[model samples]
Target: MRTRFAPSPTGPLHLGHAYSVLLAHDMAQAAGGTFLLRIEDIDQSRARPEWEALIYEDLRWLGLDWEAPVMRQSERLPAYRAALETLWSRGLLYPCSCTRRDIQDAVSAPQEGAEPSVGPDGLVYPGTCRPEAPPQGPMPDRAVLRLDMARALSVLDAPLRHEETGRGPGGETGQIAIPGDSLLRAAGDVVLARRDMGTSYHLSVVVDDAEQRVSHVVRGEDLFEATPIHVLLQRLLGFTSPIYHHHRLIRDAAGKRLAKRDDARAIRTYRDEGLTPADIRAKVGL
Candidate 1:
């Protein structure tokens, strides 16, 4: 029943973030399980000291507590690198140099009447830099690494599946079986390591969860679509899958989802307005 509230300290916490943390904390407390506060500061380019401090302040203001010596992604680079190397050794990873525009152009160009379609991870990678053979030797600097989805699936000894307590965009729930063709179309050649950041969210997240021994994953429903990819990575790396609970998102007034850029809904803004912890809990319908 171990749960975690992992937040990237790239900006101020918002109502949506408040809802997620509160839900995760409550779930852990109810089960008498461990509740961890993980700082996902992998995006070093945008991560800041002040923002990290604000995350602590906001969580305390929300009346929550977590285990000490909170885990920070930046400090776990070695672990992530090890996992990437394991996949690389298995001939699962390949270097990619394509930008967003390059992927769009390739996908846009007709190929056997297969029209370009968007996937869970946004525009399914066109595999512009995917080499016909698995790369060997040292990984290149400043080059993104992408998973070979087809090869990864084919290597699986058993069918990949995950238990979903929350519904997906298409209202899928219960135990979901991951088919080879579907995953390739939904999240083709997903990036494992970024060109600049050295590690991407998917790789870090899966590795972090396994290391933390998280038994349940409580997060926003918006991430439901990406669960299969995470499950695939977990299986590929010989890690156990955690029960997934994707709660509903806290959207804005116009039915838009809250984002880091939406300072109007930031927890700091509400605190400055003299709102109490109870008020925030009620506002988020906790």
Candidate 2:
């Protein structure tokens, strides 16, 4: 029943973040399980030390407690590298040198006026770099490592299941079992590691959760589609699959989910404006 709240220290915490952290903490406390905090600061370009310090200050002000010293992703580069090498050795990875324009052109030009659909990863990659073998010899600059989707799917015929128990947005309690096909489609050849950072979100998150021995994963429902991919990665890397709970997101008055850019909703701003932790809990209807 152990659960974790993993927030990237790239921006100030917002109401959306508070909902996620409080949800995870409440779930763990209800089950008498451990609650852990993880700092997902892999995006070095955007992550800042001041933002990280704000995360600690805000979470503490919210009355949340983690089981151990925070786990930082930047300090775990060797783990990511080892996992990447394993995937490379298995021929499950290939280097992609295509830029965003190249992917868009490949998709739009082939199908006349076809509207592009967003996958779990935001952009549905046109598979422009789905090659037969790893690009021979050495890797090039500005390249990213993409998983071989078809090859990975061939090894995962059975339906993967990760259980979740929570009240839906409408106050209905239910459980969900993620299917394998959804995983394949939503996570189509996602980037495992970018040349700039040495690791991507999918790779770093799965590796960190496993290393932390997390028993339950609770996050916003927007990430429900990515669950299958995490399940698949756990299986491929021989890591244990933790239970998952995808809760509804906290939205603004316009019914739009909050983003890091919504400075007005930043938790630090709320705290500075004299909003208490109880005020935050009530705002999110927790």
Candidate 3:
């Protein structure tokens, strides 16, 4: 059994992050499985050397250790490109030049009194750049790429499903069946590549999990809605879907979810205030 705690080094490690890491690590250790750490530094624009270093420090301070030679997403660009190339060859991907404003305008253009539907990626894309026919030439170099959700589903030989070892926000559990029609209407054409990063979260995450040979995916329930997207990508890329465990999130006093911007709850701040690792565990109700 292999589990990973993947965190983006764009900000300080907060209590929310600490709870996730600790839970994942404890679960792996109890089952005698390998626990791995991954640095999701694909967003080079926001990733910082100091924050990366601080992540290491904070993890160590929490009295936990992971496998040697951690994986970094920035070094796996070639693999992501290869996966994109495969999808492109199969006519499952298309170039999208529509910006957020363009999508907003298109979504609002629907009939009056129609409230735009929101997807996991915030405001479902209206498919402005979707081609009526799949392009034949090589994939575009500079334009963002989106998966044709309808076409992708129609090509599937079998129904898509995933094992949910943990409960979803709505208390969904057991073997979850992915309804294709729901995904088509809800997710729309999701992005695979961005102009700045060359790869988006959904694309990189599935590829990374498969490459890492992760058997179980332990993450926040906030990502539970996006699991179907990952499972779809896994099937398209011919990768095995890992067992998903979407744990509860660590929220604030006002019942709001924590964010990276909340430095007051950062582990670094707590450490500076003389909190011990056990103290952290008790604080988070471990």
Candidate 4:
């Protein structure tokens, strides 16, 4: 019964983040399980030392404590690279040169019966790099590596299933079995390594969760649609899928998801306004 509160040190913690951390901490304490803190600073371009410090400060202010020294993703680049190499060796990864704009253009162009060409991971990759025959052409000068969903799924012994204790946007809950085709269509050829960063959220998260032996994954419901891709990656990499709890999001008055940019909702701002930990819990309906 191990749980974690993995937050990116890109901005100040908001009410939504506080809710997530509190929920995870409470669950672990109730079960007498371990609680861990992981700093997801993989996107170093946006990560800040001050932001990381603020995360610790905010969590401590919230009366949440976890085993440490905390794990930081930047320190684990070598491990992520190794995982990518392993997938590359197994022929489950291919270099993709398509950028967001290119994919948008390709998806926007009308094709007969394309079903609107949308996916959970943005516009379903148009497969611009797919070769017509074996021995695909030379890799592009600048390309990110993507998992070949079909090839990865081929090695699975059975269909993928995961336990869900929380609801999805469409009210999906309970044990869910993911069909191979549906999985691919929803998250087509998701990137494993970015051209600039060398690793991606999906690949790094799967590896980290397995390494940390997390028994339950608790996060915002907006990420529920991406769970199938995570489950698929877990199976492909021979790792266990953690029980998931996609809690409802903390939104603003207009129903907009709270973001780092929303400084008014930031925990630090509330603290500055003289709000106590108990007040925060009540405000978030914990």
Best by TM-score: 3
* Model 1, global lDDT: 0.91
Report how far residue 157 has shifted in candidate 4, in Å: 1.1
User: For residues 108-222, what per-residue lDDT tens digits would candidate 1 score against the true structure?
Assistant: 8878999786877789987788889999897666678999999899899999889988667677788988788889888899999997788899999999999999999999989
Which of 1 and 3 is ahead in lDDT? 3
Ranking the candidates on lDDT from highest down gives 3, 1, 4, 2
Q: Measured by TM-score, how close is model 3 to the native structure?
A: 0.98
Model 3, position 29: C-alpha lDDT score: 93
In candidate 2, how many Å is residue 107 off? 0.9
Ranking by TM-score: 3, 1, 4, 2
Model 3 clash pairs are none
lDDT of 3 at 60: 97
* Candidate 4 similarity to native, TM-score: 0.94
**Poorest stretch of ten by lDDT in candidate 4:** 133-142
Location of the lowest summed lDDT over 10 successive residues in candidate 1: 164-173
TM-score of each predicted structure versus truth: 0.96, 0.90, 0.98, 0.94
Candidate 3 lDDT over 214-258, as tens digits, reads 999999999987999999999999999999999988999999999
lDDT per residue (tens digit) for residues 1-286 in model 4: 9999999999999999999999999999999999999999989899999999999999999998999788988999888887877777677788877878988888888788576456666778877875433224443333598888888888788989889988888877899888899877788888888887788999889999998999999999989988999998888778989999899999999999999999999999999999999999999998
Tell me the lDDT of candidate 4: 0.87
Give the runs in model 3 whose Cα sits over 4 Å from its true position: none
Question: lDDT at 190 for candidate 4?
Answer: 87
Best by lDDT: 3
Give lDDT per model, in order: 0.91, 0.83, 0.92, 0.87
Off by over 4 Å in 1: 112-114
Clashes of 2: 0
